[model samples]
Target: MKSISRATIGLTSSVSVLGVVLLAVLVYCCIHFWQAKQQEETANRALHAVEHLLLKPTSEYSPEDVKHGLEEVLGGQGRTQARVVDSRGNRMFGPEVFFNGEGSIREFSQVFETELPQLQAKRVELAVSTVDDERFLNFISGIFASSIVLWILVSVLISMRLIRLVLRPINRLTERIHNLGPRSLDVVLDDHKAPLELRPFIDGFNRLLGQLRENREQLKLFNSNVAHELNTPLSSLTISHELLQRRKLIEGEDLQKIVGDHLDELDRMARIIRSMLFLANANQGRKLQLQPVPSLRQLVVSVAEYLEQLAEDRDLRITVKSDATVEAETELIKRAVSNLLSNAIRYAQANTEITVHITLEAERVWIKVSNEGPTIDPLKLNRLFEPFFRAEEGRSDTGSNHGLGLAIVAAIAKLHGGDVFASSENQVTVIGFSIQTKRQSASG
Candidate 1:
């Protein structure tokens, strides 16, 4: 047999169920109708045989002989009820027949009356009735039960087989697609055996992936070109700043002031470039590529030691504590710590304390920088880590700040799978960061 698909199975199963149900009802009706017809025909034959036999009988034989012949003719197949009576209505023979309705003895004798008018005859009759109807009732119940069980079994088998067949092509297609990697971006998802309805959806997904690949290539090229172009101008600016510092256009105090101003500007530019590089490296998943370096304690100490003068210059005191190991790119980690220190030193009240802590917690390292400063707007805090985002843009020219410092700090932290947080209340503002530790085997 050809295998039926799910749709056809459903149709076939439904049709079979309907046919069986109808057939059962038809068979029951047919049996009742056929048996009734057969009983009537048998009764007619017996009446004819009895009239012919009885007419010869009473003259040549005894009444007992006629009765015995009639009884023998109508024996069991199904129960048969009968009666025989004389023209005056006296009972002649047969087992007792329950008198039902207004049935008359003359009407019953009419069986042979049509064939033998005015002839002496014995009236004969037969009727089919439900003596015990429970057999038919049991038959109907069994048919219903069997039908229900068969319907469930067949439906389950059909649905299961259909579900498996439908999913087979899809499962195969999924495996083929998953086994393909970035190396097979050019390859198409197999449409062979793919359902007609699903092909369009699959095609759309593949087209989307193709577009994403093209966009990524364009972005990579653009990033490279922009970095190169910007570096050229930065180099020229560096050389000009150096040559100007060497010139004697203005002497002593004036020369020192000009160089300081130019140095700050140069520092700002350098920071922007460094921030870009850190962000680029961070997102590219370069965490494992960073060299393992001194513990968090040493990194903090180094930054504090360098920024100690700037702290003192601003009448601020600095303190460092703790010893904890961490894995990170040294230069970037130092830059991040220094930015936090510089930000603290810049914003702290003129003669207050700046506290720096290096903490070792289970599985990681943390750096905390705290200072007494005015509270920052919480709304501004969220965007504080975005590139070139300056909250103090409203500040006077003399008090202006290059806002890329905190952004670069965040970038460097992320490059090492770390993060920075800021919190402030009253006169205290805290800046903190955490980093994961890398342990070395004692033998290494």
Candidate 2:
């Protein structure tokens, strides 16, 4: 199997089509000229025979004698005939019959007068019949066939050369691609010199390369952030354990407090690890097992109930408004809702009501949590869901939340084929996610 480039295929096909057209025109012209030449030859021969019969003087030759001579000269040829008639209505030369068939005929008449005798004018007519010539047709057909074969051979040779010429740029591009390596990942094909058809593909490939580079940078930052997050608790634990070991006599209450603090730090680390693992699974395109919920409002109400105590601590009230049903993993949906509700409670002003609004449409179920809080900077709204990202700017009050709450919400939404969104305006912050539902309405 020989491989061919697009340029070669295009060039060869064009050449082949043009060659076939030219060959047809050549065949038509050759046939026309051959037929015309044959007709000309027939006409010329008839004229010459008529001239010969007219030159003879009637005094020396009688009509019968002329007729015999005419027969000997012209009758020998297969399709030629002649006739001679005098004023007395006498048949002078050959038969007085005209050719009566479906073939070409050339007629010539010559008048001559008898000399030194009756001096009467005689008219001699020559009719040459041109029947279909099989041999001539065969010869023309053979010429046409030979020309076609020759043209095909010549066209193939020319097309091969053109193919190579046309494919030179493509061969260069292939070599360039082969030489590319990891070190040249940022490099892109130069589309300016590429064929018009390949530019779109080149552009798409360049865009993919840009995305991969961005992802690589994000991964690097993520790893560094993970290390920083884990190191703080581990260092504190080491210091606390060392202090307990070195102490000769530690107070009872203080000892219990230190142990409790150690456990809390451990628990925080565990939560972070679990959240990170969940995010990893979601990014890997894992599908969650979904259970249908009859009413999303009831689900939100249940999640709100569990977080009501925390909301009250900040003097905030929790409210739920829903008109949606969900088909999702029950546990995952609860976790997502809990994260959003918890965030709202943490940030909402004291004595304000945090609203969890659910809207169910034909094709999607939307869960939005809004609260009255300090206005979040518009610039950081999109990045609020990033792991370890905090809008508080490293405030220690975040506690065991560890900045993974919103991240978990995003991951769960993605796992359910949905997305998370956040916006803030005039001290009112809203964060939500929408998931596709199995059932769709007529409008959807």
Candidate 3:
């Protein structure tokens, strides 16, 4: 990438060039105006000299007198010549020189009528050459050109310094980012000291760092939980294998039962692994292939039916209410509902009803499962959907429930562009999720 300093310098140079062009035009105009003013003043002086000569007595109005009078008024400069002419256009006074100057010549004439007929209709003419004015203007232009060159050089130097000053903070930020390691994830840029223009960027980057730090901590906790969960079943299987190896004296039926228990443990391990994989995919933002669910009520009903035996064990009745049509991954939705129903059945009070309520509002479908169970602590309620985070009451059932069920439900909800929520109050616990319906997705 090109340096920002270079780009800024180029821009400043362009502005400088534009300013110089405008300044040059202004100088040229001023020089031209000065030249015109000087010529006008000189012509006025010659006119005044001619008027004085006319005021003299006609007897004293000899050509020599007229010439001397004009010369005295006009300074007899070689560049400026004056002559007096009669009505017949014959030169009668002043120099007889015709201009042969190096520059353009300008002539001024004033015809006067005198009271003496002898001097009647005399024309006074002054010719001025622009050679001296041109030389002076040239000299002034040279100085201005030199000044403009110096100004450009100084401006370039100042611009470079300013660019460096402006970019110092950004360079420092880049270096700081470059030096960051996993251990330094908590470090943040100080926006307070940053330039106003860069504060927003610094603040946003600091926020991203904050998120990364949070995710890193979560990943560490997740890894530890996964190891602890898998270790239980592995330990059980290991102990069973070791017992079988040492006790060949055990009967066939006992041996088969032991093998079956091992299989169950293996199955539990498989479920945990599968749940972890699903959570990983979800966190990675894997896209879901969505299909239209004809009725949300039917879906909940089907999940309830599948877990009917589990509900029956607790003497809990499963009741589903309302319906909504939504766009979602059908199997994932079913899995999420199954997890919610199973969780409700596990915790619900015996002989109490577990209600599955579906609500449709503003193009969103909410499916809430409420069970008559012990109220969950508000503090723990928010974390109920986190992986491996089972409530105290459910921890004893870790052999069958590794606590990934609710987390899976949360992931599925997120896959459908929704979220999971939980609340426990008034001896009734409710766990639910909301999904965007087909109409909502289409509109969005």
Which candidate's lDDT is highest?
A: 3
Q: Candidate 1 vs candidate 2: which has greater lDDT?
A: 2
Regions more than 4 Å wrong, model 2:
6-70, 78-190, 248-255, 360-362, 438-444
lDDT of 1 at 86: 59
The TM-score values for the models, in the order shown, are 0.43, 0.71, 0.81
lDDT order, best first, reads: 3, 2, 1
Candidate 2: residue 67 lDDT (0-100): 53
Tell me the number of clashing residue pairs for each predicted model. 0, 2, 0
Model 1 ranges off by over 4 Å: 1-267, 287-294, 393-400, 438-444
Query: Model 3: per-residue lDDT, tens digit, 201-234?
Result: 9888999999999889878988999999999899
lDDT value, candidate 1, whole model: 0.67
Error (Å) of candidate 1 at residue 362 is 4.1
